[model samples]
Target: MDEVVRRDVEHAHGDTRMISALAAPRRTSAGPAVLLLHDAFGLSDDMLRIAHDLARLGFPVLAADVWGDRTLPTTQEEIGPLIGSMVSNRSRWTARLDAALAAAADQPEVDPEQVVALGYCFGGSSALELLRTGGRLRGAVSIHGGLDLLEPDADWSAADPEAHVLVCTGADDPMATAEHRAALESGLRRAGVDWEIDLYSDTRHAFTSPHAKNSPTPDAVAYHPRSAARSWAATTRFLTELFPTVRPVEH
Candidate 1:
């Protein structure tokens, strides 16, 4: 079995301070490094469990907590407010993401060149920001995350086109309305970025969260076991293709 450990890493070059990262190390000599961004709920035990599972699949995963040590908001109202605030405050949050990626890539067991980023909800939405300047990331995967920014008219035409992107969003999410989805596809197409968007019907916001009864929006329901499992498999396949050193496990 692989080793799972928690790390508190500090960003050396930026204004962003220290953040918590849960690292799961594989048994092999080397593997790809992935920075996992948690949703608005912060770093829950479920996040760490996902990290461990990914590690077992041959990648060393780092699930970073961007909100320092803040507890999860108790209600949907508070959750909405927190998401609003975080999206408006991108510079600060992006810095933390940058730090997490830098730290994850620098680890001894990781292959920096093949680093990737994956996020859920706010974290997933934030992962798109990497595309703005995600040169270091070989690819990025966003699950049930909104692709829009705080500013409706913020231009992002200069993003790198070579980086791969996989986005899974709920079709019923008002936050990810039809217009928003069209805009994202348009932006990516205009930028010539290689990407794919998977829309799941009957799914809502935070579709990956195991506990989300009062999702306010109909799309904010409990996790879809099939969707979550399929997305994870697809992400793992993407990483394997990017970093060929990670061979599939033999049953």
Candidate 2:
């Protein structure tokens, strides 16, 4: 049996206490490592499940904590402040993500050269930010994340030529406006970056997460199983091409 294990890899979350940064469940296979960033929901059970799922795919996943081990926000009102703090100070949070990536690469099972950063909603954007600002990743996958930047937009001329990006976004996602997609498309193209953006019609924000549907804007964020499956399929193909050392296990 390819049993997936979870262990708390020590990573500083801007404090003395060791936070959960690595979750690499190894068997006999190896491919690319995944550095996962959580959404505003803050390292919930759903996030851990994602790590286990990735482990089954023959990939080691390091699900990083954006906020140091803290109680999950009960309401969006609480969530807003948490996310706002990170976005407002992008440099500090991005540094935290950088640290997590370093930890992921240091794992015995992970190939440092083949590490990929992935995120959902807030996490998706965070992954993109890491790559945009010189985080050495083979690829970055963003699932339903708003691409609008609080900082100045990325100068594609400076991007790493080998870095690839996959964006799975809902056509009707209010937060991820068409303007934002257009701008991102323009930048990736101008920079000569290998990137693909898949727009899922009739889908809204957080299509991959059932828990997001309960947010304040229910109409703007609903779970779309079809889109979720499709996006994951795309991600699987993209990652396989980027890191084809191991075959994915049966889902």
Candidate 3:
């Protein structure tokens, strides 16, 4: 595995604040890059680990802190309200997400033209928002993220054809139910966007988070190792398809 170098940097869009973690393979030339968005709970250890893992795979990964410098929500009780606040102000949230993407693309070790936006849960929906809003991205990936379009009536006729999308989610995830998936698919299709969705059966919300197993709402959110591994493998494959010139580090 390649040694990963990482750092925290401040970023923002207007008044919305952000603290992003940037990670990349040491001693290697810059190749592709990914803008990683955290879940509703904020940028957790698991999120950082995934960023490093992707960095080791030869991509410069930037994990954006949507919550700014505020204390991260550690419990379900705290998480809902924090996420709700951000979601309520959809425009501001989207602008902050764009700022994160721009910051990642501006990194010295990132190939600006090959940058992609990726997110988990709340962040996942943000990735799709980038595409819906016509951000200049090679692709976008959503991991166990919400699928509903925040602004259902917003125009998507001008969506970029170059921006491919991949969504991985638990089949039984209450947050991303079958109805939600259908609605998202319909919207994407109507916009003529290139996209694919992978559903892991028997899995629920937060299936990719190791910490989910310890959550009080086990039935709604819990880690499933098999689903997590499968989703990750699919994500890498999706990335490879989009950025074929970028090679993974050999073990």
lDDT of 2 by residue, 1-251 (tens): 44666787877756623366455554654457898888878778888888887778778888887777644676778988878877888778777788888878777778888888899998998988888777889889999986764243657665577899999999999888888898888878877789999999999999999786666676799888999999999988887888777655554
The digit string of per-residue lDDT tens for model 3 on 1-251 reads 43677898788877767888998877546678898888877888878988988887778898998788734787768887777776788777777777888888778888888888888888888888877887778888889887653554556665687678899999888888888887777778888789999999999888887668887887788899999899899989988888787766656
Candidate 1 runs further than 4 Å off? 1-17, 27-30, 77-81, 148-152, 213-219, 248-251
Task: List model 1 lDDT by residue over 1-251, tens digit each.
Answer: 32454465554425334455546553446567788888877777877787767766667777776666545565767677767666767766566677777778777767777777888887887777766654477778888776555244545565667778888887777667778888777777777889888887777667778766444554445666667776777777777777777653332
TM-score of 3: 0.92
**Regarding TM-score, does 1 or 2 come out ahead?**
2
Q: What is the C-alpha RMSD of each candidate to the true structure, in Å?
A: 2.9, 2.3, 2.1
Give all candidates' CA lDDT scores: 0.70, 0.80, 0.81
Q: After superposition, how far is residue 209 of candidate 3 from its true place, in Å?
A: 0.9
Q: Which run of 10 residues does model 1 get worst, by summed lDDT?
A: 10-19
Candidate number achieving the greatest TM-score relative to the actual structure: 3
What residue runs in model 2 are displaced by over 4 Å at the alpha carbon? Answer: 16-18, 28-30, 149-152, 214-216, 249-251
